[model samples]
Target chain A: MNDAQAPIVPAVEVLAFDIFGTVVDWHGSIVRELGRRYPQVDGDAFALAWRAGYKPAMVRVMSGELGWTLIDDLHRMILDAILPQFGLERLGEEERRELNRVWHRLDPWPDAVAGLQRLKRKYLLCTLSNGNLGLLTRMAKRAGLPWDCVLSAEVFRAYKPDPATYLGVARVFDVPPDRVMLVAAHHDDLAAARACGLRTAYVVRPLEFGPAHPKDVAPQAGNDLHSRDLLHLADLLDC
Target chain B: MNDAQAPIVPAVEVLAFDIFGTVVDWHGSIVRELGRRYPQVDGDAFALAWRAGYKPAMVRVMSGELGWTLIDDLHRMILDAILPQFGLERLGEEERRELNRVWHRLDPWPDAVAGLQRLKRKYLLCTLSNGNLGLLTRMAKRAGLPWDCVLSAEVFRAYKPDPATYLGVARVFDVPPDRVMLVAAHHDDLAAARACGLRTAYVVRPLEFGPAHPKDVAPQAGNDLHSRDLLHLADLLDC
Candidate 1:
């Protein structure tokens, strides 16, 4: 679905990536963490169930059906509901809270660190995630994700696919919309970015959802560039 | 006023530095940038004149006489006034805007980067600058500042010396006031931080205002730690 032959416009100055699946191995990390913490629990099922609650919880905040809430808060809300579903009734409040923060300690894909380091040497690289500043900052520190800055939907008080979040990065840098690029594994995010006159790069993360679930295997891209991973993206950009 | 025998408390978990002269050599940077742009202009005098307007502009914002403005805006205001004062009227509006952002491209002190890197391995290091997030983020990228996160008074909509600004960093990291240390070269800034239940580190920047302006040489011990530079502070902390 990509237009490889289309004339590529060279406009983007900052390349912002979606954090969860685009940069890190969220499902793998969550399952690994769950297995380590609760050996008897169905780690794979728990990971999938935990992630299932994410989109709905964010919808609550995005629709203003709930007050402005951070991703950390959203994660905690989802964690509380899933705890009983997994039959983990004995987990104390402190343990539950710490476990919810496993999102903050999510492991980076092997290429993520080296690719980002290389990209950072040239362009301004940051996380334009739906995550909150506190969550993003802690994640970067814990996982050694060297972000130039962490720009988020929390900064704009709106979630992704929202034009405000896409344009806010450009506005913060005092650059034109076309001078910013959204690099994500999801086509919807790229479409939203393209709608805002920003460039887009599609990164394929086949295992983002784990072995039980399949990501879109086809090279479906509405973006300016499609690459295998961050390193390939960096190479494509000649960085 | 030096207290060599005072019982020392444990070092703070986060050491947030005031950036203007604490982390970066602002005077040197501004003077060099001004000299590069206008060879005929007396860069030293021009820098001093530009800096002189800073406090008054901040006062207007602080007094609520003016709406809350970012330091980037305040810097531009000073730049506009001082550009004519220095008799350099050749710069266009775009040039002036870009030049005003030399604040965001200021060079870090020789010890600043190394010290920050060392401290980051042990404690969370952030900028509690009066400069806005955009300015701070750009500066960090340009100067290779390894801040785990960058916190600014702009985040709190309050300028430094305001208790809210000092306390904001602690609140952001979910840490107590006592666990956050304000590291600055300015005595007034350190005093304000100490008043707000934060520990303080005094790093002397003798040439911060050039040879004409002298820094406080005597160790007043008003702060918890007094060091010659960031490296010395790192040594004291055993980082």
Candidate 2:
């Protein structure tokens, strides 16, 4: 296939990643960590329920109902609310803090490290995530994600799907939005980036939610590129 | 010789770097690049004069005399101010802009890559630089800097030596200030970081300026650690 850098497309100077499910296997990593720590609990259910609370928590911040909260604090808020329901309330504060850091230790999808290296050679690569700088930095350290830089909504004090968050990547690199392609698994994230004039690359993470949660595999319209995974995106970009 | 983690000191969780003279040989690199591009001009004088304008320009942003400006822009501002003094006023806008990007391609000091890799094993290594995110990211790409995150004064809209910039590293990692150490060649930078309760590691950069600029070779008071270079710091930290 012709690379995304073919003459027909606008030249992209930077490739910003959405992170979480898009780059790291968040659900699997969470479930595995939870299961390992709490063998008695249904880790799958806990992981899903915890993740389910993420956006709504951000909405509170985004809508001005809640003051600005770091992902670490927000993740703890959800974890605390759901722990008792799962009978894991017996965990001590230190243990809860340790568990909350599981997000900081997520395993990269098998392709992520290698794929990013390839893409990074040709284009500037960075994280354009809702994750806080601390969380993203720790995750990159633990997972060996070779990002040129780790950028976050915490820097902009805005959440993903917010135009500022999408456009902020462009701002950081001082590139036009069209010269920055957001590569992500989520349609909404790509849509937001596109709305803000960024080129979008949609990659399918079929098991992003594990087997129980069926995800859309179809490529969305208006995306500049689509791929099976980051390696494929690397191939498509001739990286 | 124990790792910096020895019982005598606070357990530093993050090692934030001061780039430019500390990590990259800015004087040598800038002089070399400038000399390569403009053999007719005195690159040494140009380089020193360029740097000489840096702090005063930053003072504008820091004191609200001017709004927040990225170092790249400020560097250009300095470059333009000194161009006429060097009889290089005829340099076009595009050439001046291209030349301004020389800051982004600084060559790392010999031990930086290996030392940083070692430090990364034990500490969350990051760039706590006044350079804008774009410049830092590009420098990392060019120099193989293994920063876990590239943070900037731009993120806080405050320049270094400010309380906000020092405390901001700890805030990013959600660690105590003492758990974050500022590693730099500049006593003033380390002094400010220490005042904010951050641990400090002062590394000597003997030739940060060309032979003409005799820098202070003695260690300053208040720094928690002293090293000949990053490799020595890595050894001291037991990384």
Candidate 3:
């Protein structure tokens, strides 16, 4: 690796994680659930379509078109809109509510639990997800993700890519932004956290979307560390 | 026990804890630490004075006399004020800072960890304390308190006895108020949660102010459950 690409070790006291794609297999979890419920449907396409609606829904709330809404509500709205398109509009309110909660039941990446246990010995670990606190709490309990704290956009009343969410983690811990590192699978999240003066570590989740549509795992220029997965990130951090 | 004194079981989905004197032994912990540092001083009196400053400090913030300040700052303010009276004003900045963090290092009650582990299997566990998120998180990490969520008055911008802090627990989980139980040693905290339509569990912490001053452990009229300690609460909850 070139000098610019080498990992820059700073004085990091906290690690804030991006939950959905970085720590958990959201798309794969959704696809598996959908396949179980409706074997005839194209589960992959449905999973992708549901996730595709996430950003725009968040944009509406961020732009104040809708009053502050939790990710659970946003997921339900998206699920309701896409169910008819997938010819599954017959699902009842209870079914839809249960289906919408698939986000809470997303399976963690294989390295996530063990890697977190290792890194948690050295630094504070928290979720910096757009997911609501309840959702994050349930997910952590179910997945055995040993987070020192669970923070959400619901807490800051702002979503990721917004500076408040990234900066809020540091403020909660009473630490400078540079002492907190944002660990994620997405470059956009790392960039936003970096913009807020936080250190950044990118862990590539190649199958974030699924096997058919692999996410780009290329190392971005400004991130302090880049690794194949969470375990690799732990190794790089000397955990 | 009479009808009013008997445990009234409810479908509580979450157990919201009052951290300081409930799950942890703040007075005992503070006195022990203070005794170790200032061997010639009256550590019990010093500890009580420090804790006595807590509610009034929170009242200042709650009454809008002060801006939204964290408990950590309040502790520091109280520490600085009481140091002179205790003949410990000779301590420097770094020593003072470390001393102020005694709250973060307070040990849990003997049954706190095991009782919480059992209750956690049956219900979601969270802290609903006036303590700041950082303090609670650090305390949990140090004392091995397994909270699914670390909530604080800082999150609600209001301290205990505020309806916002009580109802906020239910709102976070998208559950009705009764599904969230406030488990506290203080009657006022439990009463506030009850007034907000939440279930209330009162745990007795008789030595909260140290062995010289035992707190009243009489069962209140309104609490749905009363127990000698957290382990008893776990048994009452059928956990």
CA lDDT of every candidate: 0.85, 0.90, 0.91
Candidate 2 lDDT, B95-132, residue by residue in tens: 99999999999999999999999999889998989999
What is the TM-score of each predicted model, taking all chains together?
Answer: 0.93, 0.97, 0.96
Tens-digit lDDT track for model 2 on A52-82?
9999999999999999999999999999999
Give the winner by DockQ: 1 or 3: 3
Note the DockQ of each predicted structure. 0.62, 0.87, 0.82
In candidate 3, stretches whose alpha carbon ends up further than 4 angstroms from where it belongs are A1-7, B1-7
Q: Which candidate is the best by TM-score?
A: 2
Top candidate on DockQ is: 2
How many clashes show up in model 1? 0
Better of 1 and 2 by lDDT: 2
Count of clashes, each model: 0, 1, 0
Candidate 1: residue A121 lDDT (0-100): 83
As for candidate 2, its clashing pairs are: B4-B237
Higher-ranked by lDDT: 2 or 3: 3
Number of the candidate with higher DockQ, 2 or 3: 2
Least accurate 10 contiguous residues by lDDT in model 3 chain A = A1-10
